[model samples]
Target: MKECTGVGEMSEMGRLVLLGAPLGNPADASARFREVLATADVVAAEDTRRLTRLARDLDVTVPGRIVSYFEGNEERRTPELVEVLAAGYTIALVTDGGMPSVSDPGYRLVRAAIDAGFPVTAAPGPSAVTTALALSGLPCDRFCFEGFLPRTPAGRRSRLRALATEERTLVLFEAPHRIAGALADLAAAFGPDRPAALCRELTKTYEEVVRRPLGELAEWAAAGEPRGEITLVVAGAPPVPAARPDDDTLRAAVAEREAAGLSRRDAITEVATAYGLRRREVYTIVHT
Candidate 1:
């Protein structure tokens, strides 16, 4: 473990520290985080109000200058922060919650620092992403963080459709109100039987994690919207069949569809739906 030092102590050496704060619970903050907050010469925070509240909870006083560094100003602030870093300031970066740069402001500054040969490191803490992953009961060994889905239904659905066949477990963040719609879209794109978990208010008094099939979860979310922060974890699609269907099987499926008095396109669609085969595969078999 590295010892935390004040900015004055490190003024001679230029460095940028990406500090991870507690997602919701202050108790999850590490000792090093307190020290960094206490000593950093410049504290770049996503939200000053939230940062102050966190400082009060931890009983640590920030001796450095605090500045806003959020989505709207990140691009504009990056160059200025970089200048401070170059001037040998031990700058500490923090987000409103959780780790900075995961889905928050800090990436640009960290990247700039690294490119400029300034020392860079992290002080890890609680993450909604990992917390949800643990509660999800889904495979976490291989997973991808999608951050938040698009706000609109069409955009969100399109994004989910693109990941319909993704094999690695998926993690996403959603607002309380949008959770139900997101779940519904996920079920439609990934199938109803896909296992998933909805984590809400993690590490707080009202923290809840509900694990169920995506279809069932969507129904539950529809009944009533949840409050507080949310993290959604969904199981990935199973390995696809390795062998293609033989010509005989395809002919039999097409014959059954034709006997039902359906058009060729409708018949192929029905067969594909019934057998869980791709529409193009069924069409190729029927046409050829």
Candidate 2:
């Protein structure tokens, strides 16, 4: 591609550009990231200060009007940003870290821009999700993203229980303070021997990627405070036995899962699928 600077220069009326920034190390920033931030007419940033700091580090002079659009004010600010975008102005939406709308707030504006007949796209760059998954040494052919989990212990456990039998590799973002609790929940929900990796401060000086089972990870985090941003990659559940699971076997499996705090309904569904049986049969077996 040529050296394209501005979005308005294209054939579209207005464009909503999701500009990606580095997760930790600023050098991972792409040239296109700088160009979009430097030339776009309206720049919507999760944090204005952080954007400026990034530009300074990259030696890229920002020539656009910067506006704050984070989780707190995204709902209120969507209309205003859509208006600017509708007027043939290019607006770059960036987050404090990572891309917009992954775990950050930009979906509303992106939707509004699209509804208004404006073009939308992303200036792709570093993402903690893909980066961590690449280094996680786990299956990546099929995977899923489980953003930040609930804060309350009960709520978190409930969500983990729901995902207990998920077969695809899972990617999650978590805060430092809740690392131990989350790992413990994973251990309890997915079993202590479940394979997992904890990636911390990605691409930064204190960066650490610890690969182990959920139990060992929980123990490690309990030993010391694991600080900074965290991305967790968890291996999927192991394959079940080839032998057809009988009613007694299915009931035991469901009961064990239910005892692990999963709802009866979820337990039945999981057991039914695991043994390739109709949900009605599993439901009858569990309820009666």
Candidate 3:
């Protein structure tokens, strides 16, 4: 069997280490994360200030050069980071919280590094997605992570409508200020009775998780918007019961089939089989 190469094994070309920072608590950072931050040749952070604060909190010194790499600058910064990788200098990418490139600024650099033939790996750590899912008491067997909802109300509603029938549990991230409006729209689109949980400031000192129906959650948010990072876990849509065709519809089906060269008896059989009914039942309806 082929063996998996370790992240520490650096080739002539330096690797890109994707670091998953603590969701909120600095203590959640792993030992490998701290080591990478301390020893990497370059640390590309979504927010340099947050990275500095996190380093300070973890008692880790970032000896490498630090640079701002965010949404606004990702396109321009990716090439430079790749160039650093080409120079045999390991580049560690960290976001403000959680894993980078997860609705964060790390995709471009990852793609660039891979395309440039540089190795890319991660120092796995805490994530708000799984944290919120576990705390929500929702089924995690099958789920989807929708990083953030559309910024505009119309766009959000449109997106929600498309997902209304999704059977798998749904997870989403929302900004503090937009939490209220997002909840309201969720209730409107997914229906009031849909079960959901709201997770805030996960893994932090004042963390909160509220499990409620969409209606109650919307009402709660309307009363007062909760602060801090918001993660929403919503139950999937309930199974829709199949409706049996009525007398008029059954008659129409027989007539349509008869018009299509099927005999009345054959049409009744076809319609009965198609609608999962006995031939006698369809015949009575067709005759009556």
State TM-scores per candidate: 0.81, 0.81, 0.82
Which 10-residue window in model 3 sums to the lowest lDDT?
1-10
Per-residue CA lDDT of model 1 for 90-202, tens digit only, reads 88999977888898888898898889877888888878898899888999999999999999999999999999999999999999999999999999999999999999988
How do the residues 79-177 of candidate 3 rate in per-residue lDDT, one tens digit apiece? 888888776778889999999888888988998888877778999988889989999999999999988999999999999999999989999999988
The global C-alpha lDDT for each of the candidates, from Candidate 1 onward, is 0.88, 0.88, 0.89
Which pairs clash in model 1?
7-39
Give one digit per residue, the lDDT tens place, for model 2 in 155-214: 999999999989999999999899899999999999999999999989999999999999
**Cα error of candidate 1 at position 118, Å:** 1.4
User: Considering only N, C-alpha and C atoms within 3 Å, which residue pairs clash in candidate 3?
Assistant: none
Q: Please name the candidate that would achieve the greatest lDDT relative to the true structure.
A: 3
Instruction: Give the CA lDDT, 0 to 100, for residue 209 in model 1.
Output: 90
